[model samples]
Every structure is written in C-alpha cells, then in structure tokens.
Target: MELSQEELRKKFTDLSQNPFQQTKFSRNTKIRKIIKEFANFSQEKLRLENKAVKIAGRIINRIRRFGELTFADLADQSGVVQLKVVRNKDFARVSSGDIIGITGKICKTDLQEEKNKQELSIEIEEFIVLAKCQQTLPDTAHYKLKDTEERFRKRYLDLLVNTENRDILITRHKIIQSIRQFLDQKEFIEIETPILVSEASGAQAKPFITRHNKLHRDFHLRIATEIPLKKLLVGGFEKVYEIGRIFRNEGIDARHNPEFTTIEVYQAYENSEHMMNLTEKLLHYLAKEILKKEEFEFNSHNISLKENFRKMSMIAAIKEHINLDFSQVNNLEQALELAKKHNLRLEKFQKSIGQVILAFFEEYVEKKLVQPTFIYDYPIEVSPLAKNKAENKDIADRFELYIGGLEFANGYSELNDPIEQKKRFEEQTKQKELGNEEIASFDKEFLEALEYGMPPAGGLGIGIDRLIMLFTEQNSIKEVIAFPQLKSKTEEK
Candidate 1:
C-alpha cells in the first residue's frame, strides 16, 4: 500500500519531538560485531550485565501489538539483528521503513534448540528516529519493486530489497580490488589519465562529444585509455596502468554500455606473448580468489577456468567454423564471394579483403568460442595500432580473449615504427572522411609522442564491468553497474 501525503505528514509529526536534526550520534558497536562478541545466546538473562551498546540501522521487518510488545529486525549493511521493545510512546510509533538509533543490552531467548539458541536479540532501552521515510516501500512477500519501472531509476531502494543485486555490487568491488592487488604485486604502477581529449584515437569507436565554453572548442570523452598510457610509456614510465571510465557513443545491448570502466596496462619491452601469459594468470587468480572455485556458471554455461585457454588464429577459427579460408583469397572479389556464401553482411567502408575477413570471423566464429579461448594474429587491416609480424606483413601481433561468446580482453605487441604508425593513421583518417562513423580522428599529438621514440611495449585493455559480470554470474552488463544507463521515462512512453 502506498502512503498518502497526509499519512506521511502524520509520521513526520510523531517523529518531530524525538530529535529535530542532529549533526552526529555516537555508535559504539555494529550489528555484526555484537553478534560475534556474544555467541552464547542460550542465557536466561534479559540483559548483558554492565554492557550498554549503541547501534543504528533501518527497521526491515516488524511484528507489533498495540502498546503491548513490538519486535522488529534492524538491518545495516553488515547484518541484521532482532529488536525487542515493550510498547511505550517513544518507540510504539516506530514503523518498518524508519531508520532508528537504539541504545540496547544484548539478550537471548530461553529456547532449547541449538538453532534457536544461536539467534541474538537486542532489548531496547532508548529509541531515537534517525530519519523518517516518506514514501511507502513497494515490496512484499508477493509484490516486488523489481517489477516496477522505477527499479533501476531509483537504485538505492533496489539495493535495500534485492539480495542478489546487493551481492553482485559487493562482488564487483572485490573483483576490482583483486585486480589491483594482482597488478600491484607485478610492480605495475597505477596512473591517472585525462578523460577529456582533443581527439579519441585508441580504438575504432565513435566518441561522445562535449564543448568547452571558455575555450570555445570541442573535446571528446576518451573511447579508450590506450593512447595516453602509451604516451606515459614514451616518457620513460616503463610500467604503467590506468583503470578509469571510458565513453563511447554506440548502441546498447546485454554487453555494451555508453559509459563503462576499463583497465589498460602497458609494459615496456614486452610483446603480445607476455600479455597472453599475464592474462591467463590474472583470470585464474581472480576465479580462485573471488569465486572461490575454478568453475562457475554464466548464462547456464559451465565455464572452466582450470583448462588451458584454447588458442587459435582468427583465420584458423573462421576456417574451422565456416570452412572458408580467407588466406587463400587474395582479392576483395574472392573475399566478398566467400562472405556471400556464408550470408555475411557487408558495410560500405569494408572495401578491402582483410576487412571482409574480420567481418566473416565476427559473424561466424565469435559465437563458437563458448569456452575460454584466445583468437590471435588479427589482420593488419583491422589492427591498425598493433605491430605486424616480421615474416608476414598482413597479420598483426594481437590477441583477444573470449569467454562465453563475448570479447573480454584485447592485447597487442606495440607498433614502435613512427613512419608505419603515421601511415595507418592517415588511412584511418581517409576512412573517417569516407563516412565511417565509428572511426576516430587522427591524433597528431599522439603521433608526435611516438616520434620521440617509444620502446617496444605490450599493452592490454580489459573491460572491468564485463569481468564482474562473468564472476558474479550475471548475464547483462547492467546487473553489475550500480546505475546503468536507461532511457528517460518520456522516451520509454
């Protein structure tokens, strides 16, 4: 039942006399600690002798009789404890949705069962209204706030009611913590980089544009952390890493968000091979530490982290799945013919044979990677920033880790040749001019940094949100994010 304005006003009036607006209150113990310190709950005593403790939390559940007795569960982020109150004017007006501060003594019921004996209860000596909630909570044994449109729009209430969502959020924090610990042990220094840039050029994705009024110029939210981290590499920061928010103006789906977080790591004098080994060890550590097992479930698929991640070239994967070898096709005409045979859609900007090979792999081979797999040796046409192989100029030293048919990480051996890098940027600029909306503009400053002599480096970018999804067994990226992007209510209507 929703609370009317008049009903809410009455609640406020009842709480007004207690404490008008206090700056601070004393809290001697948390609910979890109280339960931990007093484990022997079988005592017949009504109160802990000489033990006066103060606690505060929202009242979650209640059972009451008018001016006789009241029992309610007080819940904090740590845990919940039962409150025993003999009805009085002070706390008899207390409701389930209110936040209350309690000065209490610990006690236990005389129930003989071991399970009942373990339950700790608190006897309240004083009650003060911390905050009076205005609106009625929209949750019950049958109805849930999750069924309403306001769930994601108002996430604080959702966290209060949804146990699984709360667990997913807590798991996310631990996942990032474990990642930082892993990288720190490897001697990787974490750095902060600018979010606003003149041009976004690290990846092939459209950027969100914003304007600066003072300068009367435009800037873009960074689409990737690759460029600036590499500039740090050129400046003699041999090993650096950054985990920050990245923005891309793109379509939203189960795995994609406009603004998300990524961790990009760059190590001088390392190659894609070193990155692969690091990726394997990092993921295995996260699984063992966070999930507490090498095996977990995602979208009903059993993902085994123990197995050595299968490795195959992009071309090999395509040939295995679709039985078509792009290496055998030398021209765009032959590649286009093979694409048609496999029913692949062609974009106007995808005019080259290598581009067609990438399209075929995305359309046919990605979904086949149900297990943890690495698709390596990408074509140079798609991997503009990766170094080309010495023996074959057509393939770049890049690998992407895929699990549950989703791309989780992309890593590459650094392309240190200034002249070759400039050529690649020029080609990308030409493509942008030809109306490739997803292409980034040529970054002259980044090119200048490369000209200053960057060392051979290995770089990797991992989507922190998606990794959380995998660990928490959530199917959608929104489940892991606290406040996911949602269309406005008017747009929804």
Candidate 2:
C-alpha cells in the first residue's frame, strides 16, 4: 500500500513535533536541509513522486522506528543522500543496508548555518525499500575500525563515514595525475610492462611465484618496473616511464604493502645528476599541485620544499652522522664489528662490505634524515644497474631521496656497458646462491637488451604509495590505498 503526499506530510509533521524520546535527529540532517535550500525548491515539490527512480548503492545507515521516525541513507560511488520514514509503521519494517529507490521532490530548506546565515539543503523525497540490511553495523564512532584486520575486511564501511580516509585515496589519484602530466610535458612516453615474467631482473625483492599449468613453467610477478623501461631506452625511446603495480612477497607494515605502485622513468643521455634534479622537481611539483602547499607534516615532522635538498655521499653521510669514517672501516669484517658496536643486527656468516655498510646506514643514518636529502654514491655491490663513479670505483652513481625518515625516490646513471652489466647480474646470482633472498636474479633477456647497444641513460623509481602517504599526512600506507590487502575475515574462526 502506498501513502499519499498528504498522509506522508501528516506523518512527518507528527514525527517532527512529538517524535519518540529515544529518537534524535542526525547531525547530517541539518546539512541535508542546507543543501536542499541551496538547491532552491520547496518541500511540497520535493515530496514523494509516483515515478520510480532507478537508484542503486550500498545502504550506509538505517533507521528502525519502534516509537520514532526511522530510515537509512544509501550511498553509491556517485554520492550519498539520506532516507527517512516519519511513520512508525513504515519504519518498523525497514533495516540498515537496504538498497532502495527514492522518489521525491527536490526540495529546499534552511537547515544548516553557514557564515552566520542559515543555508538550504537537499534530500531524497521518499524512498522505496530495495534490499534490507541483515547484520548490525559495527559501532562507527569510537569502537569502529580500530582493528587493522577488521578495517581492511570492511573497507567499504571504512570509506563511508570517514571523509578523511576517502580524501587520502583521492589525493593518491591526484599524485598519479601530477606525475603523468609532468612526464607527458617532458615528452616521456607512458608504457605498460608484463606483470608476470620468466625472470624478475630489477630490485632485490622477493617475488610472488606462480605456476603456469599450460606452459608447465614457473613465473614470478614483476618485482620492479626497472628492466622493461630500460629496454625501451635501448630501443631508442628518448624518455619513458611506467606507473604501475609491482608485487613482492614481503612482510606487511605501516610502510610496506605486498603489492605497491612505483613510477620508473628513464631518460637517454642523462646521468645521475640529471636524475637528481628531475627527482627534486617532480616531487616538488607533485607536492605543490596535489597538496596545494610546499610544506606539510608527516609523523610529527614538518617538511618544507622551499630549500634545495641536502646532498651527501653514502660515505660522507656515515662520517657526518655516525662519526665513523668509512675510510677507516675498509673491509666487511671491520664494518661488521662496527655494526655490532652500534648493536645493529646482521647475519653471522660472511657478508659483503656493501651489505655491512648498508645495514649500518639503515640502523644509524636513515632515521636522522628527517629532511629531504639525496644520499648518493651507493656501494656497487647493492646497485647492480648503476654506473660506477669515475672517481670512486667502489661507489655507484646512485642517489636515494629521503624525507621524514622514509625513502621516497631512487635513481642512477644506468650501467649501459653490456659486459659490466653481465658481471653485475652474475654477482647478484652469486649472492642469491649464498642465501640472500632479496637478490635480483640473472635475466639473460635484459642482458641481451643491453648488448643491443643501449644509450647512456638516467633512471628513477619512486614508491608512489609512500609519496602519497607523506603528501596526505597519513601515518599508514593503508589509509592512502583504497583496497589495501587485509587478512581475510573468512579465514578467521
């Protein structure tokens, strides 16, 4: 049975005047009314219309009337609006999480105060029940979404009722947009690379493995966007970049996601110095465009883009921050002893001098880099794809940008020498054989690409998630990622 407009108005008037004591008006109602008034329509015209509107979405909130007006708000990807039932009979039957079509007048009312003046609002006139909610919503105000496990499981709800959370994800899109615009203006062609590869040849990160039944071969999810993007450089593309997902079978934390987005770019005829400048400019532009400010806060630390970034070699950084000269610590054994002196953890067996120094830097030097700094001239053992510095045979022409104690960007003057590249890949293979799990595997195809006479190019890789986190002032990467991986609730007993 359908109630007429007069009856509905009477019901609403009755509920508004002498509503049940237990029922209180929602805070959003005033805002809705303000929107209605701003739309400039009367309540009568906004009243229930006979036509059925094809409305669709998840039910955000529900009202059940025992002695008061009750209803629920439905939200789709488009937007959100409120639903109400002033009559007790209609309200008693409806529940939250119901999908429904609402037909009503687009009315206006002065419900919300803005700038010392009451403002008009908008709302759905009358709603038809589509699907009823079965389970009760978790307490959303205080007890809601505190558990990391549950939050990921109920990501939809987390996005709802949390505007700040939604904004973080929206900001990520803007960050990507800014990068695309920046690169496109610089004539860098955007490209897509295969996600599943015969061999992963980029970063020293564990790959997620899968077996292809038809091919009867094992394949790995690409660990980095480095190899293929560089192959384009060999093919004579002057500039190229890929903003895409890379998979790594790694531990999860506030900083790390198993699958994450990275932007890898390469420019022919440029070196590490050019890459450093590009890194600074790109990041500064992203911060300015996406955040609309050159300064922001992250982890209680204020970061400014007004000044040029501090640049220091890895050895120089160790000397300045650790007070231990890398010149004095000449070998792996001495470096390991120094690490132990600083109470830094490392494998008991033989490790390369590069690994020992890196472990020491991670422990002692990285945290002290609270501002934007370019830590360059990395040890050749760790940077296999980077060219060796001409003056220092031990250090590669690589630089990593750090801000707020998080590594944001890494770039290098690429190793274009096919023979030297082969030797470096072999070293990586040797390291892998020695039980270092995160070592890059030898890729014959990538070496073949280099052998085809690749140009001297500069390349960079920036962790998109971490960059978004910093710009949005979010403490956790999950906040900026819309559907970050969560432990499956079904797996829980």
Note the Cα lDDT for every prediction shown.
Answer: 0.85, 0.76
Considering every candidate listed, which one attains the maximal lDDT? 1
How close to the true structure is residue 171 of candidate 2, measured as C-alpha lDDT?
76
lDDT of model 1 at position 12: 70
Candidate 1 residue-wise lDDT, 13-37, digit = tens? 7774644475566898899898888
Quote each prediction's TM-score. 0.94, 0.82
Compose the digit string of candidate 2's lDDT tens values, residues 1-493: 4457786556444332322232322122333333434344445454543222334455554452335544455565445555444553644444455454544433333333444332222244454454444456543334456677676767877776565677778778888998999999999999999999999779989889999999999999999989988889888788999999999999888999899999999999999999999999998898778778888899779999879999998888988987888877777778778877888888632387887778778878998898899999788888999999999888899999999988999999999998998898887777777787888778899988888888999999999999988898888988888888865566665
Candidate 2 shows a clash count of 16
Worst 10 residues of 2 by lDDT: 19-28
